[model samples]
Target: MRITPKVSKAKAEPPLILAIDIGTSVVRTMVFDRLGRAIEGLESRRSHKIETRAQGTSEANPDLLLRLVWDCIDQTVAEG
Candidate 1:
């Protein structure tokens, strides 16, 4: 004969407010509760492949960066 332990699911919490900061080097997303207390967060570094060659150079793949931002936000939301 074998005995098995029962598992219980945790109660879901209220939705949190999300904040994001995107820069040339990295992207970050944070989640806060109604009271402005941080609940969860995520960060992702920009791809090194995207770069500039000459002086006053600034290069970026808008589509790729946008996708990264979305991914970071999604991760933070899921954690919260």
Candidate 2:
């Protein structure tokens, strides 16, 4: 006599939660389901760095940072 093994499959659903982190040097994004399990993620580094020359000096390019943020978001969304 021969016996067959049974297999089970789980249902699939769309992701529920999305997390994004935008830092001065790096940007990262992640997607998670209702259970908080990560499904997709992406990270990218800034092309340019913001530096201060003096104790009171401060500088940053908002346009560049915005571009990097969009790039990271696009990549992460594409991975999904």
Candidate 3:
């Protein structure tokens, strides 16, 4: 998977925060300002699938999730 970050030229005023969300099938990364507002064009996202067994068991690969998180963070920072 490749991360295509949204590029923003305007710098975020100080006190920036990085937010990461790992959902059932998607991982997201965003940069927010002190006021809790997302910085424009500073976000990344990746989608993944979970394994579902016939016995009603759900499984997710930890290593894959970790890699997604890393990629999101790296892309967000690189864009910011």
lDDT of 1 by residue, 4-78 (tens): 222211222345556777776776776555455554332233442458777868788888778888888777656
Model 2 stretches with alpha carbons more than 4 Å out: 1-15, 40-48
lDDT tens readout by residue for model 2, 1-80: 54322221132134455567666666666555655555533333345577787787867688877787778778766755
Clashing pairs in 2: none
The per-residue C-alpha lDDT of model 1 at residue 80 equals 44
Please give the lDDT score at residue 38 for candidate 3: 74
What TM value does model 1 have? 0.60
Judged by lDDT, which candidate is best?
3
> All models: lDDT?
0.58, 0.57, 0.84
Q: Which run of 10 residues does model 1 get worst, by summed lDDT? A: 4-13
Better of 2 and 3 by lDDT: 3
Best by TM-score: 3
